[model samples]
Target: MNRIDVHHHVIPPFYRDALAGAGITAAGGRALPDWTAEAALEMMDLLRTATAIMSVSTPGTSFLNDTSAAVELAQRLNDFTAELRAVHGDRFGYFATLPMPDATAAAREAARVLDNGTADGVVLLANSNSEYLGTGGQGELWRALDERGAVAFVHPAELPAPEVEGVPPFAADFLLDTTRAAYLLVRNGIVRQYPDIKFILSHAGGFVPYASHRMAIAIAADTGRSILDILDDFRSFYFDTALSSSLAALPSLLAFAEPSHILFGSDWPFAPVVANQYFANGLDTGVDAANLAAINHTNAQVLFPRLAGAPITTSAERPVVRLRHTTQRAVARALFKLVQPGTN
Candidate 1:
């Protein structure tokens, strides 16, 4: 199957060098991997990934607090990716990086990148400098993206805590981090308000699908909305299978997400070649041919029509069908009331 990998990553040379210069050798408790355009292309060819939507991995520009530096770095990275897309148009596309936590700077960069066609969309870390996207002045950034009806790819970053004794952050903490961001966004009602902005959650939305009913229950209780209403909002976000195409994770993702919302992803470089191969194999064997075709490429084409160069057939274009967790409302309401004492 021809795959359009939405969750693929790019680590630019300058960014890598900057990290090394700052005496930083790792990100999210893992050592950074070496990356090159030639290497990425070779791997894509082997893996049958037709196109990769690239973005810089975590510890993004927010690793530095200076707004000026952040702006410069964001520009430089977008420019580099744009050049790559220009040279390798068929094989690569990119999500523009923005320096967040400084909402003003982020807004400016978002406008500049999207307006100039330097990106297919933008990639945002779940939290930047302990400031989650749903908090503080991030509305400016949201407004900017919403204005253009932009696609915002959400990736996870390390949480604001030291690593636990033996656990690697990427394996577990990253999941929690992404979950936290999703929770805050739902709680803040950002998803409903910004209907135009398509938020693509990486790593199968980081425990979101499995825990969505629970999340919806909490939101319902807090906002005085019905469980069903909250659940609908929770289901609206998009999910990408990066390192999460295994049997353990795929079922929940497939059940909770809209079929049209499940996009293919290969979190390359960071997720080593073997790991990528493993997940690709899992997806190949695990899903039915029809669903697999959508996850592989068609779903992504729906989100990014620019990637669809050839004529799209009707069979390949599946209408988005909303799938609900039948037991969620009854179970969640009981749990919510049980946890909150006399709130009901």
Candidate 2:
């Protein structure tokens, strides 16, 4: 399969050095992996990935306390990735990095890159300095992205909470972190208000596919909106299969997400080549021919139409058969009990 990997990551030399300078050597509880354009292409070839849309992973520019310095670093990283894409147009696309928790600066950077065609989209940390996405004061950035109808890849950062003694943030907290951001986006009306900005949730949307209804019910209860409407908004976000193609996860994801909203993802160096292969194999064998083709590349072609060589089958073009709300509610109740055993 010539897969288009949407969750690929890139680590520029300057960014790595800055982390070291700040005494921050790891992200999401793992050491930074070595990355080069050549090495990335080599891995892509090994994984049978035709193209990889790259982004900087967690802790993005958030490590820099000085907003000005963070803004400068973001510009440099974006320029570096943009040049890489310029050189390897056939193999690579990139999401521009931005200085966050600084919405004004982020909005400016987003416009600069998107207007110039230098970025496929932008990658946002699930939170920056404990300020989660969809929080107040981010309207400037959201408006800029919405105006462009941009693709925003929401990758998880390290959780704001203290870590458990033996658990790595990436192992579990990352999922919760992504889930929190997704929940806020829907609950705070960011999804509804900025409908044009396509949001791609990484790590198969963390716990989203499994807990969506539970979250939807909460949102409905709090806001007095219909649970069905909230659930529909949850489904509107896109999801990527990166380290999340296990038999258990893939099935729930496939059942919960619209067929066209699921895209292929390989976390590359961060996930190790062997792990990437493991998940890819799972996906390949899990689905039938047509569905496999769509998950691997066809579905992504709709989001990035320039990549499509033939006729495209868009989400709108595909038949959408939603699960009945009553059934989803029943399953949600069961899952809620499973995850929250003591709850009423």
lDDT of 1 by residue, 243-280 (tens): 89877899899889888899999888887765676677
TM-score of each: 0.89, 0.89
Q: Write the per-residue lDDT of candidate 2 for residues 148-263, one digit (tens) a residue.
A: 99999999998888899879898899999999999999999999999999999998999999999999999999999999999999999999999898778999999999999999
lDDT of 1 at 214: 92
Lowest summed-lDDT stretch of 10 residues in model 1?
A: 314-323
- Off by more than 4 A, model 2: 310-344
- Report per-prediction Cα RMSD to one decimal: 10.5, 9.2
lDDT of each: 0.84, 0.88
Candidate 2: 10-residue stretch with minimal lDDT: 313-322
Cα shift from native, residue 202, model 1 (Å): 0.9
